[model samples]
Target: MIRALNLEDLGSWLLKANGMTSDIAEVAARREPVRRFCVRPGYRARLMAAGQPVLLWVSGDRRRVTPGIWAAGELTGPALVADGKLRVPLELRWLDDDRRVHRDTVRSDGRLADLEVLRQPQAANPSFVTAEQMAALRAYLPDGCGWTPALSPRG
Candidate 1:
């Protein structure tokens, strides 16, 4: 059964891209207007929704591409089931090679060391990123990338 994601639970997410299956360099070079990322079917995929922030993590050593967060964007729409798979529409806000955050860097940070992607390397596509982790990652992003956490009601 399909369930609605809780708005209060919304936060940053990590979407892994396999370098062997996907040409990271080509995708980064194209700077496509919009892209659809597929996530493994399960609870995690069901939690995804439109307007939530997303980070594209390039996985695998293929093409000599360093594995890490290569891009940041927002989900343009809710998860859609196509061909028996779940896909989320994304619109990238930042995708600069210089701004790429390497896995080593993230591991070195205490706040990001326990990231789901790092903990379970072979985990499914959509990985959860806590608000605190997202804040820590913001430090690595360059100024004017237009990345800002969604304000809370209490704030």
Candidate 2:
């Protein structure tokens, strides 16, 4: 099992990433959980379930920081809190070698409505990812990698 990490801690990391301050970044959170998203250097944000290499954009716009906003596209994995800093559950996505006993299990939690699999060998991600999954993805972030509290600008 992996040690569960919180978005608050993540924000601290992101502050170091962008050369920002944790206290100020926490202020950027605006009393909400932080969020990190994977995006390409060009700014295209999305990650397929198969673990294909893609650009990642770690973001969080606490009121005390730049942009003071947060946004992104498909977030593949790593610990990203969705509702009020609650842990979102996530299961693995693997291709069946045809030697398995049962189909892949589905993840369901109260904070998130549901993240059902649209494809077998691949997964069609629906909503935001869980905090645990995001932490594991730090390896793929850009040079300024770290945590960033997310604040939605609009729908």
**Whole-model lDDT values for every prediction:** 0.73, 0.25
lDDT of each residue in 6-39, candidate 2, tens digit only? 2222221111112142343343335332334222
Q: Write the per-residue lDDT of candidate 1 for residues 5-55, one digit (tens) a residue.
A: 333543577888887677765768787654788888876676676667888
TM-score, prediction 2 = 0.20
Q: Measured by TM-score, how close is model 1 to the native structure?
A: 0.82
Model 2 misplaced stretches (Cα beyond 4 Å): 1-121, 125-128, 145-153
RMSD of 1: 4.5
